[model samples]
Target: MSNKATHASGASSDGAELRRRNVPGESNGSAVPTQAEVDNKKSHKPKSQSSILSTLDEYEFLIAPLIFTFLAFFTRMYKIGLSDIVTWDEAHFGKFGSHYIKREFYFDVHPPLGKMLVGLSGVLAGYNGSFEFKSGEKYPEELNYTFMRLFNSAFGAVCVPLAYYTARELNFRRPAVWLVTLMVLFENSYATISRFILLDSMLLCFTFTTVLCWARFHRLRHESFSVEWFTWLFLTGISIGCVCSVKWVGMFGTALVGFYTIEDLWNKFGDLKMPKVELASHVSARVVGLIIIPVLVYMFTFWVHFLVLENSGPGDAQMSSLFQANLRGTEVGKDSPLEIAYGSRATLKNMGYGGGLLHSHVQTYPEGSQQQQVTCYHHKDANNDWFFYPNRNKPLYNPEEPIEYVGDKDIIRLIHSQTGRNLHSHTVSAPVTKADYEVSSYGNTTVGDEKDHWTVEVVNDAASNDWTKIRTLTTSFRLKHTSLGCYLRAGNVNLPQWGFKQIEVTCVKENKPRDVYTHWNVESHWNERLPASDPGSYKSPFLRDFVHLNVAMMTSNNALVPDPDKQDDLASHFWQWPILNVGLRMCGWDDHIVKYFLLGNPIVYWGSTASLAGFFVLIGWYLVRWQRGYQELKPIEIDQIHYGGIYPVVGWFLHYLPFVAMARVTYVHHYYPALYFAILTMGFMLDWVTRPLARTHKTIEWAIYGVLYVVVISLFILFRAIVFGMEGDNKQWRHLRWFEKWRITD
Candidate 1:
């Protein structure tokens, strides 16, 4: 009954035949059958194949999934582009797509795949990138954003068929497959969300397809390198790249595939009869398909990203001077510091949480410290400029001189270049993180007292490199206050608008010496009398820029605080997502008729949730009984129930659980990936329950199928206005609010 043996024996027709062809249960892929069972099956075979019930089964199996898939497409596409006004995220993402069309540079937090496709769809549809894409901006009669929405809708439409196929591959019977497909198709929230210019629908499509591809791969495992096997594997890799390109959320798909690959390989390794080289071959092939190919495709999206975006936009402020110089429309200064030296004007960047430039401003923290605020800003600014000076006041000294370089343990003071204030710290508590000391530009004079003296420690040093010597963009350093022993901290916390919304900087000592928050780097160097190179020559290496961009993005994501104006005001927690605790208003909340709200069909949503619980209860009962020796199971049973059913559960958790941990605001749309798995689990449970009964009354299976389908269709009929748009004040909206959390009433 072990899954290892099930995988070994159940995948082959020859292995099943070795047991017996004498009973229907023999080939069920779970257990062997007795002689009586075989005789019973033989008696029923003719009636099951030719009787009225059998005929009904065939029509349902062959026609229902397809019909539901078509319905899913139509329901999603009917007047899909009805709303031309920019919805919540449309202004930003739509504008990003326009930037791509104009070949203009901009920065976004996600991987390039989703936005790149959006931009490509716009270009193909003849959008000229002239729309300003301002939030709440009404679409002009001449401007068409329909094609981009249509592209996402088309992909979103694929989820229904993919669900059907994936369930079918998992051995769910016709009734179960139909239920699964319809559950996805009739979901109200998916219907409304997919029709908008957003990435969620497209991401769900790719995520669902990736799971389906893996199911196909599992089914073809016996074929080795056969066309079906290779094709499924290739498709899985491509979808991983696609999903990952869309958002980092796709990493869960990559993880699901990765974990399954390892398990599959473990099973392969246990096959003693298989040649040893077969394991090597399997690993090598998967490495190519899963790792190398996906990575190349991921990089290719960036290649296209860099290719299309040449002109600089608002994003230039976040990048290094060297990176900005490569962008069009930016003035590149044609000078470099002779060499980093004492009295050199330098921008010291905090290589801490999120990596920001050490910045100061006239604004004060206002509350706790109340001194002039010192913080780390992600963008380039003159406020970030500072002059490096010796801690002990001597007439100016050259710590940057090669012969007399600043080395490790050197005491130094940094003077704010703009305000001529010395960088100083005090015993006052920081405004946000009270335990940490408040760091600010306190003294007016360039000469520093004890509080202004900081010891510079070279981070990446050997016998050859010194701490006192400064290099731009090459070396990293840590500044420790010589008096209090606290290290400079860029905790990646945000300050209020008074501080220009930069990262909060404090002074705190840590138990460990390698705390990343204490590190710093020189971002820009300015000195006269040294040879000047082309502004472009000092640019960080191309590879470094790519790494830097990703690092900056990760840092930004980690520090993302919700903006009331941008994120949905009705953002739901992960717990609320599954039950439809709250619905996001798409647009038009006033008394006007014909409004859109993103809410899922409760029948499908709740059914999926119940199915998730049912899977555990149903599967756990059989598994526990078998494990406890109270019952016996056949290889086919193990294959059908455990091996087949456990995956979607794993996938459901993989997709759903992370949302609970995310710091970013989440909406109901986030549950769609988990919903796919829930639907599959529901289908499998229905199939497992009704399979044996099909030979007898056919009543249990058909009755449940009829009721679920009828309910879903009725819900769809009642909620037609949710997607197509209807008057918000209508009684229909009030009726749709099953719970106060639904917020269906405009």
Candidate 2:
């Protein structure tokens, strides 16, 4: 046959085959179908079914996330209000919220945004801020704590969908994305911490948001400087600020973003095709979105904090004398004598950057002479009051006598006004700083001892270089122990619970004249014989006050160390966290009271840890295979490994490794952020392991995934009691304990 005849014969045979198969709209061997036949063929399907499948195909990306988010919220809000009593750190954060509602300025180590949100929740729920929020305290009927809990729960619940979208942004397959969402949604620890007025939920929420936004931004690098790129970058910055505002731990998340940006910019810098102007634009955009915006947002939170808290509260003493003066109810440097005089009653403040007032109480030390405890107290109280009496060399300080100005080289006896005892230091070892002598209050007003004597040596006068009389709130002075020649010091060494967690007072034998801890100044002075100084002279600028308060906050935060004398059952090491060696008791172990334990699901945590290990192993195996002239992964797979696998590992390291070097007390909750990255890594591993199986052995791949889903869901059910609240005897529920170190039942 000719070439044209051959082509026509093939087409006729194809049409005959189509008609025999009875394909839709192609019956009776018709080569062309009319519009009526086409419409009839489409109408053979049910209207609702066709419409539903079309809608599913159109919005398929949103279906899984929406379902996961609803389930997440349901789980988190299920029994959030079960406990009417305060649990764990609610004692601290809840009280902070109350302080905000009452407009009472209180000092805490953490930033104010988290507590501000808590206070906002309280305000919305109509809480009066009258409740003390003591640990394990029962909530009043009108407290509406449930609403506050629900508000916090909302943040944690949203984290599930954020994880899902973040996985999708990382190019995870649908099954892997579902796994990531399921891990976060069912994680017992995350859910448990979210059910209270604490900051962890907010912190986690912002952290997840930052990571998700960063992933989106990274994916849009191909569309650099596009509106979508800029939007994600800006959102990442805002999320960074918010996360950090909740707690300093958020800096770890910030560091993750920072590392990714630096690497990205460095890669772009090496590209020869990139013009200098484009590079500059990239640099400027990152600087604005990552650095400037976050800083502005952080500072704005503080501005709001300062604007709201105008009245003096318990935290007034933590601030500088001048800053305290600015508070409405504070009497700092107000109507107080400017110059120190004999028989003057005053509070001696340590002149260090974050020092406390010299205070003594009637409670005796457990060891070291067993005398009345003298410590550095950060709060104002009557115990801080002291009488500056003249030494034995001078006549007994009397109100009837003429006003005697206390000058340099004057020997004085500091009498604890509350205890009628002198500030005494002896050769006995200090409670914490054993190298120094113990400082204590000893001897009644009628008795006398040389140890009680201290030389008042003025270091310098703030108002004048040439001044004989000591000045209040300005003169930097030292109290040299007359007998031991040691200087009275408060070096931020915190004491045990017996000492009320106050800074330890010590008599340092090393006479370092430049030691700020040894420096002392009169904070609150009272002398009926002297005239009040000018209040206008004590005006502290806002910027100076702001810096001073932040430094003070950091100093106090660093001082939170474990007491060597006692065992902190609540404390855990960083290594113990990953292995699930311990769990925290969120409330009392009372039989009637509802209890919550902060613990991760064993299956989820263990699998995440394994996934982290598996990442390194797989990467090593691939490198070795490539070096041996065999390639296991293609270019696309390599890119996936770099962006999805390596990036999450970096994030995990950034969030986790810092804890190893930290001197502060750490707990399992500290590991939650790192746990999130680990979860991502786990999702990546899941996808990597099942990728080939999904293409070839589809049944086996689905079976493995099915097993995982079942195991994860089953474990969540088993661990639900820990998050939802367990009551009655813990011994009865001991079967839930999976590890020897897990003290969950107890």
State the weakest 10-residue window (summed lDDT) of model 2: 19-28
RMSD of 1: 5.8
**Per-residue CA lDDT of candidate 2, range 1-746, in tens?**
43222222222222223112111122212334568975786699788876887677446567778999898888889888888998999999989999999988899999989999999999999998999999889999999999999998899999999998888777676677778888999998998988888999999999999999998787677778778789999999999999998999999999989999999899999999999999999999999999999988888888888888888898888776656666787777778988888889999888776789999998999987999999998878899999988777667777897888888888899999988999999999999999999999999765878888999888976567865888877778999999899999999888888999899999999989989789888888899889998542755566756776777889988877776877988899999988788889888888898888889987789999999999999988988989999976655467678888999999999999999998989888999999999999999998887776755676887788788888888988998889899978888779988776777775
Across 1-746, the per-residue lDDT of candidate 1 in tens digits comes to 53334333435433323222111143323354578976787697776564665455435544666777788779889886767688767887888888888888787788777887778888877898888788777887766677778887887888888887777667665567678788788888778888877888889989988988888788678788987689989999998998988888898989989999999899889989889888899999999999988887777787777767878776764555556657776643335542456666788766553467799989877887577889987676889899877676555555445433445777888889899888888888887788988999977654457898898877863122544565555556788988898889887788777776778888895634678678776656776645564444444555656666677677677666567546456677898876767787776576653468787787887777887888889877887897888756665666777545778888889999988888886777778888887778777777777666665656865887899989988897788787788654655568788777766674
Deviation in angstroms for 209 in model 2?
A: 1.1
What C-alpha lDDT, on a 0 to 100 scale, does residue 283 get in candidate 1?
Answer: 94
What global local distance difference test value does model 2 have? 0.84
Off by over 4 Å in 1: 1-69, 317-321, 331-346, 351-353, 365-369, 380-382, 387-392, 396-413, 426-437, 453-491, 495-501, 507-532, 561-568, 592-594, 627-633, 728-732
Per-model lDDT: 0.74, 0.84
Looking at model 2, residue 28 earns an lDDT score of: 15
TM-score of 1: 0.83
Question: Which residue runs does candidate 2 get wrong by more than 4 Å?
Answer: 1-54, 272-281, 360-374, 381-383, 388-471, 474-488, 495-502, 505-518, 533-537, 564-569, 589-591, 632-635, 697-699, 727-735, 739-746
User: Every model's Cα RMSD, please?
Assistant: 5.8, 9.2
Q: Give lDDT: candidate 2, residue 388.
A: 89
Residue 684 C-alpha lDDT in model 2:
93
